[model samples]
Target: MPIISKQHGNTLLITLVILILFSILGLSLLSISISGMSKNEIREDNIQSQDLSEKGIDRITHQINSELTKKIEENNGLTRTNFINLLNSTVNKYKCTSGGSIADSNGKTGSYNACIKEVNPTFEKNKPTVENELRKSIVFESKGKSGDSTKILLTEIEIGAESAPETLKYAVGTNINDKDGIQDGEGNLYLHGGVSVKGDFKVDGNIITRNFGYAYLNGEQWIQSLLPESIPSDGSTNSKLVLGKDSYRLTTNTGYNNHIDRNTFTGSTYSRTTDMKNLFSGEKVPKIVQRDPVISPIGITDQKANFFLISGEYYSTGVNKIPISNVNKSSSKIIPTYTERTRECVRGFLICFEYKNVDTEKESGSFEMNGTNRFNQFSTIGSLELTNSNSTFTKGLYVGGNLQIGNNNTTYNSNNYSDITLDGPIYVKGNVNIQGANLKSNVLLYVEGEVKIQYSTINGKPLTDGKQGSLIIFSKGQIKISNNSVNQDNPSQIKGFFYSEQDLEIYGVGSNIRIEGGISARRIVLNAIRGRASDKLFTGATKINSNDYFEGEVGQKTRESRLQIIYDQEIIETFSNLKQPEPIIYKVEPPLVKERKI
Candidate 1:
């Protein structure tokens, strides 16, 4: 009985040890299962965070593309401020919760924020490069967080260059869509007498030709010409001109038997046949549109005016003129000096004129020539008439009304002591009558009304010499050059860019007219033919006809007039930096993801 008792005790001890081993094994298995579950959760969270980050980037990109499409359709450009506003608005749409957390549609709780890192733009020759060559890149970064997982995405977007405004691209452009033929007839563009254009020629309506009426273009010529009697099929000798939805007309009332130098007519000519549509499917009529800038007037006080002349109305009679000693001084109130302020005000406005109605009889003023005077920039709300004045304008001039330089028979001769130098641009809202004056190099004149140049000298020296100058004249109305002649001794001669929205007429009995610039107009008329011997020089029919008859015989002794215009390629840059179209997002970089342990 004692031996059996001892063996039972031993067996009980072994059983207890086995039970302990089993408990240890069970605890180890439980721990392994929990570890696997935790790892799986971590992996799923990481994926969710990554997907949230990618979705955030995609959403921002879509928003940007949509906005850009709208801007492009509206012909608007995206500025830096506009881009920042877009990002801020997008962030607000995907608002986070009170604890700075939000759940996506996929039921994953995460937070995302985006910011702009950089915006860089590249330029060429001081002008924006072509769309393909333009370099405008932006960097965007997005961060997303979900539970203990966080993901970051970085992206880069390249924006395409903005195209130039159509109005600025053409040497002569108008927005007249004269459905009725009345306005169209008066607004017809005319070309004649060795006229040349260095850039494209665009007109909104019909085009008319006068005697020897031909336009020489270094670029393209877009005209809505009248259709010919019969259209020709494709032939080597056949006219390369295509019939559009418009018609063409000759000044002589003749047919389309006009001659064009092969070298000058490198571009295709299109005319409209019916209903203002191109007969040839591939032919296109370049349209001329209008664009106006916002006018914000700057306010001036007595103190400000004392430093720089700023006035709503300016009048000078006799030998009185605005003195130049007052300009570019220090202002007592403004933080910046008056010179700095004046530069800032006029820097954006090379030329500016605002039209305002004034009593011509009461407000008409003139500046008489007496002594030499200097001015930085001059602007007026009314007409500006200069009579025998020797003035030097260093910057620019703007007149709300007419700009008359000299009177009839008043010769403007520049001597060593007495000279008039217009160094910058001139803007006139009304008529421009320049009887005799000397325009320095790189001078530009823009008129909103009629332009009459009786006698003038442009660029008193040759282009080879550093003293040579260039001139550009733009007119919204008719342009008439009567009895005008260039300098005889100057190699630079008269280089002029004469552009008219309406008719460009040149009338001379025997005087020689030589212009080294270009001429772009709606209708160009040249009446250089000598007056008939039998015809009376003076006509007694009407008042308007009497002046024409008197001036007719004044230049009759010469018997012939020589008109020449040679296109200059250097003036092309003068019209650069105009308004441009909106930019486009061309390329988008793939989103880069980075995981962070939180």
Candidate 2:
């Protein structure tokens, strides 16, 4: 009976040991399960915090874009500082609530706080401080917080000019109506043969091109056409080529035909246009038109003249021969002979003057030269003619009527003897004719009428140090260059600005025409012809040409004349103060976001 009792006690002890082991195992499993749940909850909270931070960035972007759009719609201009203030205000409006918590539209609860850590505004290089509207970019470094997670987001915005028009910013701009390539079409702008523009190429009408032409705005190629269909807005179409409102198109045909080769474009053909406009505003379109620069006539008086050679009452019955020279002799009051002339014999030359007379109807003044005429100044009321003469003026020449340079007679082959030089400013109220005359000057030639430069070498002095003048030839009427006026010896070396209020025509068989400075005109026509009628296409008028033929060669001769217009930054900058189109901003790179742990 004792042995049986001991065995029962041992069995009871074994059962107690087994129950203790089971209890320990159950507690271990419970602890492990609780730890796993806690880890999952922590991970989920971290993910939500990151998402909140990203949301903060997106929210700020949307707010800023909306505010900018509103400002643009109001036509209110903003400076760099003003833009930054707007950004900061928008960011503060979308900040997290008091408890470091914010709720998204999806009912997801998280905490997010965003503040602009850094503000950077970019301005155009080499521009004046007053042109701060030409700011290139503005960057905002923002920090967002959600619980223990944080993120750093970089937002960049581009800025542009407000008063300038987009179309006028190009090297060539035309406001003429070009319907079916006629009407105001004579003034149409043309680009061809490796032409490069530093700025944009804006045209109110259609564009016509035959060779390759490239336009670079701020060192970037501009390839998109300004057609309505090319624009990003929903209501864009291919109707009117809106000035200051559309992109500049490049094509070989007048209407939208063979556009610039896509391979030549810098970015996607149509993408950059939308991207550029987006940088300005998401809602409202940018301004297009602006005032043009005013050009006034330079004033002159009789006190500035040396001698009044042509009296105001004198009328030309025929070609009058007037001998002008600096030579003066006390012995002879009458004009000396042309053969026995010496520089030491004269103190100064005679100057022609004609006052505004209404009573007497004077015939067009004509002059025939017997000898070399040197003068300090020359002025005329009626049309002044210089046929077969060697003339030189040191100070100025003001012609109230037409100033004919060479003989109009086709049979007149004395062009080699026609050498003219003017050192100072030349103001002509009528047309300027340079026919077969070798003219050279470092002067400002301003013409109120048409300018014809044909079969001559017209060299303008380049701007140099200590020389404060620029070779500016401005014409209120058309400027025609025919039969190789540019010196072939210096080929493509014509420097300075050549501007025309009317159309500019470059026709005739000549060497490669290279205009170095800037060419701004109402319209530009480029044609290659072997006859005179083709030259009249640009002049907008008909005049008797000595070399007229019954049937002339009129075919598109592209190889004979290759036109090149290279943009000169210095020259363009000098004229920046003139009225122009506003600039458009765009983003070059994407936004960058990085996660941070706190």
Candidate 3:
């Protein structure tokens, strides 16, 4: 009985020890599970906090950007002073001390604070501040927070004028309204070859150019509102651009019969307008002040001189008059005789023939020159024609009546080659016709009436000597260029700035032509259709040149126009010479973003 009792006691002791061990193992497992759950909660909080901070940044950025866009739209452009004011207004309205909190329905929350400052800018006190000493930037700071996460963001927006685009720097372009291309076509433009233009053309007409050459077209102010990657909203067919073939490609090899393929028909889709309109609007042409001659020749005042030599120092419209009416024996023309005998009439060899009598009633006594001639300073009241080739005029010519220039001069000695040379300013009141003349000189032709040029080599100085003044033609009436390369000895180039209050026209001959310079006009017409017409095709009033290149025909795809344009800086820089108002320009840079975590 004593032995059985001892075994039972041992079993009871083992059971007590086993129960204590099981309790310890269960307690350890429960502790491990609780620690894992706490770690998961911390990870979830971190993700939510980071997202909230980013959301804070996005909200503030969007709001500020919206305000900037609105201000720009209202003012066309924001000046430096105006921009600072805007930034201050925005900062006051939205900025917060510490931070402003934002909570979402999902229990995610964020806080944001904003501040703005200018970066390294110097401006004159109380002055209009036309120029900026150093490029300025608007820097923005945003402090974003959510839960335990915080992020500081810095954004920089640059301010100042940007370099003008290649298209906007053309020496030639049309100056008209933006919607005119849609509403009226008043600002129509047509060009080919290496074409470039300023930022004012609104033409909807199909422009033509070569496949390889560049077509640079800068649209109007409002047209630039759309992003570069976006197209016009209306999506009209007229807005589409079509470029012509390089006539030089098959120039001699193909004739009217053998033409180019249809694949060469390319379109101009990369037209870029600028924010410059909002920034700067050029002033209109100033009023012209009439300038009178310095001295009047005593004896020749009674009779109206056809071609005269005036002697004296002069201003814009100087008249020291002498009539060499019967100088040339060939035709009944008045050619200005340049001799030491006639050169004595006026000082500085200044000559004026009836300059002040430009009234329409006094349009009689037209002057004509039939042979080659050369003269110094000259001005006339009646119409004058340089009929024969190789005529040279130094200084300038101010005419009151119609002038016919550059008749036929095939052979002439020039470093870059020219049949006619007008080495100075040309001012005329009546229509001026330049026919079949290769002109080589620096010309600033300002005409009150229409100016027509055909088969001419205008401003074709050699590249080395091209520093001469550009060929600037400003006409109150329409300006037309046609059939330039009828005889394709030269390229029939017209370089420099061309402006017309009315329409501008360019016609395609069998050969190619190039125009370099800034051009501004109401509208443009590019007629690439080619055909031949006999002398009997027109009436007696229309003078017929047997070698006329643009008689007109139904334009076929194979036979197209070849044209090009380049260089515009000279136009913008020298437009004041035409008594035009100046333009102010600026540009906006992409924002630079920097971020930091705390």
Candidate 4:
């Protein structure tokens, strides 16, 4: 600090001031850069967290679904409870989330947390969602952490359930592909004799209608009330059961899902278009009543007069069967349709009747009935034949062998028509044959063998009453309902429940095959063709469908369809009490899945 000129001093002071200003500006810029970097880091973390969350959930769901499919295939099937147990075993959104070891987008590591919970099902209101197990759902959630930032994603998976319509609820529910691994027309159905179903008709395989099958699903209203209500419409397909025109030719192809054969089909493939369940869904249909060891009063010749079947009284057979005849005692030969089963009562009708004293024909230890008494819960160990007219059977009957009803010697008429009346819950362990005028019933026939019905009128309660009234037949073998040579202008009402593990066939010519209830079989054949029918009414030149005819759908009694099916609550309730083999669970359909950010 020696000698200084005034001008030089001023210049030095100015220089010092400029330096101070530059220093302040540099400090400010440094502070700003640090703040910006910190903010950017937070933003990057948030973005990565979201991405990780998304990826984590996707992987988790994909893994779970894949595992589920594998399990079902491995186990053949898994009950709802079992499925849930498996779902719970998927702990820690994959093991990577366990120790904060999951890879982040920035090559960093982060942890994820996940959870699953069962929630109330979201089903449509006022709709009949039967056997859906309350339409429950499982909510899945996962959170990904990145740089202290977390993102959560959630998804809901809903499973669907249903009882096999043919087994209990529907007029017809058939799984034709049960016997064969393929679905090549094995489950096809043909409607004939103007035969129609008045209820819902479901075929799990396919319908092989040559002349075309008619089924009137009540259009929009019907769809709204029925199952289609829950399924979304794919604009490409109509909601009706399209009886494809090329099936007769298609039966030759021995394969499943031959899309080329039914490519033009515009029918509903059910609600889940996105994910259709596998037909080999590892589940079996529910049985009506299994042949278990139960008490019955039908046989047991050792218990004489021990149990009196009073009129309108319920009785058990105590694991035996009732002999239908007293003359042969061990014989029953009342047959025209099921004559092949004739053995014990093989004597001439008159010869057997000679020793038949209806009054004092009681055996020492046999279950006996006097006069025209009515009884329920009767069992027959052998063949049971009914030639008596205007006969009525109530409640339940178990036939361990064959059962033949109606007079094979005479045709049924309004006045001459033999009426063998019956109510619900009957089990026939053998074949069944009946030839009558009005085969009416409010019953369920669970036949272990074939069933043949020559002439039938209306049976049981009428559906117009808007109540549960009709007949339901579930056969383990083939079923046939047709007209005899004497049938003409019968214009019969073929309503009730018909199900066959094999083919369910209905042959009609002269009669308007108008059927209510339901008909279900592996293959349903309705032949209303007039090829063999003549235009004659009981020798009076009765009316017959002399040529090919199409009234409406293949299985309806009136209106649009030749066949239709209506639901019945009474029948469903009946199944709840029926004898079961084991704890039953219907098949589980693939779930509808949805996801979103939480």
lDDT of residue 151 for candidate 3: 60
lDDT of 2: 0.43
For model 4, what is the C-alpha lDDT against the true structure? 0.44
**What is candidate 4's TM-score against the reference?**
0.51
> Per-residue CA lDDT of candidate 1, range 45-70, in tens?
78777777766666665665565546
Residue-level lDDT of model 2, residues 365-423, one tens digit each, is 44443245554555554556664444554444556667776655332233453665434
Error of 2 at 583 (Å): 28
| Model 4 RMSD in angstroms | 14.1
Per-candidate clash tally: 22, 12, 24, 68
lDDT (0 to 1) per candidate: 0.43, 0.43, 0.43, 0.44
Displacement of the residue 80 alpha carbon in candidate 3, Å: 14
Cα distance off (Å), candidate 3, residue 498: 4.0
- Tell me each candidate's TM-score: 0.45, 0.41, 0.40, 0.51
RMSD score of candidate 1 (Å): 17.0
Q: Which candidate ranks first by TM-score, i.e. highest?
A: 4
